[model samples]
Target: MIEQGYNFGYLDENTKRMIRRALLKAVALPGYQVPFGSREMPLPYGWGTGGIQLTASVIGPDDTLKVIDQGADDTTNAVSIRRFFHRVTGVATTERTAEATIIQTRHRVPEATLGEHQILVYQVPMPEPLFRLEPRVAETRRMHALADYGLMHVKLYEDIARHGAVTTSYNYPVMVNQRYLMSPSPIPAFDNPKLDRMPALQLFGAGREKRLYAVPPYTPVRSLDFEDHPFVPVRADAACVICGSRASYLDELIVDDGGTRHFVCSDTDYCASRPPLQEDAA
Candidate 1:
């Protein structure tokens, strides 16, 4: 209905129905990656085609939508996604996390607490946690069916042998409900905890990978780690240099030629919402 006036390849209702069916399967299977006939978007595949397609299916006239990339609305990919949605659906848009009914994100999760009414759609590059290790889907599926993940434990042990730590900073693998192994996407391990018992529904989609998965509110997801080394969420020791919020995950920013560094909250809404600190006055 949208593209007849604009250009070409505007997704038809049949395409929307196909995406909706895949979404239903994803929600039912939790972490299981449901294959979908992903349609091409105005934006490139890596940018957020899955997120946009999922958004297209679930959006209603009353929803408030927010889009962010690397914590900024003005980020190039975020702008492109938002423009496509605006042209197609004419949905209301905002930068405030609290005000949004649905949020689509790339590279970071919003730091503010989300409510049951909100939905989080993540743009994922790779949805399989075992892809790096096993490479073959047939083998990985058997491993999952048999509840086998000794290889994951062994990989962590090797990391300790070499790096003195796990060394994995993102795309940390976890067990959903202690039964199904799952990937929490490339968001730092610090953000993994936020997924558990969150008020809003969490959905992960990978366009290039042809996968769509979800984590319902209040579901259990535990990262794979050892008792001696333990799984450490990145930035557990670093506080935001700008907002002074210690709880939020941060992206390291190298500010000087001397290699001096600072940490900034990856959630733009969360950082902007924080009150001015005493350090800011100085």
Candidate 2:
């Protein structure tokens, strides 16, 4: 049941219809950014107003929602968004990646493999991959139309010249369907590989930019790189101290004032799903 005064999923029916139309265009075009009438939400712009709007448009009463910030379900952003939906839509919420029907994320994709039943909505601060290189919107759109990503390649080559490799750790540029260059939000390079031919439908929304895009299930997504210097997904060379997970992306935590550090899984749900280490009897 929806809250008393608000429409279902918070947005008005007409607004939802408009957003859905934009989303449809986005999905159809694969990597092209489709402009939409972005609406104001209770939250600020940078804190996922776009994702909230997308979720509001698509989510139904029976859908199970999950929101994660940088892979953690308990972060303030995640918790607040989860509670907001629960309050407004009375929808079921879960921390488990496998259980969620719709997952709205910022900065990181869930470590668990998503299936066809799930939709991954990313909160993008900037939708244009060429924005940093070319500030002019018109020029960027032209470049995208011509499939001219020379600027992006030059930028990457510059990184190699300075740092000895493509050192872009987050928001790495990718070529979608071999046609368009895309910004995969701010997700770390470690998660970039997961975007390639992913089973789940992926959607990106930028509220401040008023842009939306999509990568339909099984669409090809390739990280940009040279033949000699291929795209390599890098992560902390440590296991999760809590779950002893060696494969999941690890977050380094400063443990003490003396600078001692410990590593843990960024995906809290994935970490928790691992079996606890058993101690041998003494």
Candidate 3:
């Protein structure tokens, strides 16, 4: 049974239409952030209201939804948001990364490679990569319009001078489609490499900022870096203890007062599906 007093996906039909149109514009622009009529969601502004809106606009009855926070499916925010969509839309929900048609994520992309059929919606707190460097909105707009990103280049150069490398580990800026510089959420630099030439369509929504953007399938996304010091994706030195997978991102777990730390895969679905490391019987 559908919930009353709220339309499908908890958004009214008119608002969905407006957002759909805005989404079309966003896709067409391809990395250009487009302003939209951001409606007040039942949830708080910063708590993935933007992603929920985008999910609502795109999801259907048959679509399987997956929500994750920092690459964990069982985390509090991910659980709550998944439940919210299920209650509102009654759509099928799955924790398995491969099973979801539309995956809404915050701060990390899944370790599993997303296919062509899937769409990833990122919850963006700050859509503009230049906001930290330049506070004024009007000036930033002009800079983007003129294809000027000198400030960004200078910042990267300064980082190289101080740290001997481009030290931006997360929320690394990238040039999308060879035009716009975009923030690929707060996903670690490890995940930034997956953003390029991906089969899945990536969309970003910033509710508080009232803006949205996208990266089409197979789009070229190059992380901003200098020629001398090229971009590199850093990962934990240790492999996951349980899964024994070195490729996946890991979370450090401190075990005892002696400060014995163990590493585990941050991606729940990917870790769970992998076979246990074989032990040698001598």
Candidate 4:
């Protein structure tokens, strides 16, 4: 049942309208962070507050919501967000990626491909890609205005010099529409390819940072790399033990104190939908 005494989707109608206006500006300028009046949510920072606010803003009574953390629907963060939306909006919730009209995600994207009808909302801890390299916010904004990405290229080159490859496995930087450098949230580099020319719309909200950005459908998103050292998506070589999926990203788990390890699909819905491996194949 929908929670009483709270507006639909939890936040008031005016706040939702305000967020949607910010979202419009974000979609217009892909990868450009637009400031929004970030509201205080029931949850604390670093706990998907931005994503929750975004989801609440866009969701309608007809929308089907899905929440995933590190691509798993059953994780504590995912489950809590899903339940929270269900309670407040009373909208239908599902674990299936294809079924959801909007998917609020943390850390990882789903293994299944998204459609044009779907929208993906990301919880971002830090919206600025140059935050680590440049601590001053004003200078970073100036750099972005000038389209001066020399520092980012230099950082990647330094990584190659020290590690022989780009060591940034998550929060990988990308060039959006050949114009702006964007941070694709904290998703593994393995999922970076999915962001390139994605049919579905992508939205990012950084609640603590009070920033919002977007990538409209079919927008160009290229991972930053050099010709000699092309961008490569890396993942575990082992197949999923449950579903025998060789392509899906796997999470390594320690089975015993002896340090024995096994690999399973990080995407629970994708794993569950596939036929399990035969006893002999296992």
Q: Which candidate wins on lDDT?
A: 4
lDDT of 2 by residue, 222-249 (tens): 9999999999999888878887888999
Q: Top model by TM-score, which number? A: 4
How badly does each model clash, as a count of residue pairs?
0, 0, 0, 0
List the candidates ranked by lDDT, beginning with the highest: 4, 2, 3, 1
* TM-score ranking from best candidate downward: 4, 2, 3, 1
lDDT of 4 by residue, 143-166 (tens): 999999999999999999999999
The RMSD of every model to the true structure, in order and in angstroms, is 2.5, 1.5, 1.6, 0.7
Q: Where does the lowest 10-residue lDDT sum fall in candidate 3? A: 273-282
lDDT of 1 by residue, 61-172 (tens): 6788899997777788888787777777777888899999989998677888899999999998888788889999989888988889888888888989998998788888
List ranges where model 3 is wrong by over 4 Å. Answer: 278-282
> Which residue ranges in model 2 land beyond 4 Å of their true spot?
279-282
- The lDDT per prediction is 0.81, 0.94, 0.91, 0.95
Pairwise lDDT winner, candidates 1 and 3: 3
- Error of model 1, residue 101, in angstroms: 0.9
lDDT of 3 by residue, 101-179 (tens): 9999999999989999999999999999999899999998888888799999999998988988887889999999989
- Candidate 3's TM-score reads 0.96
Two-way TM-score contest, 3 vs 4, winner: 4
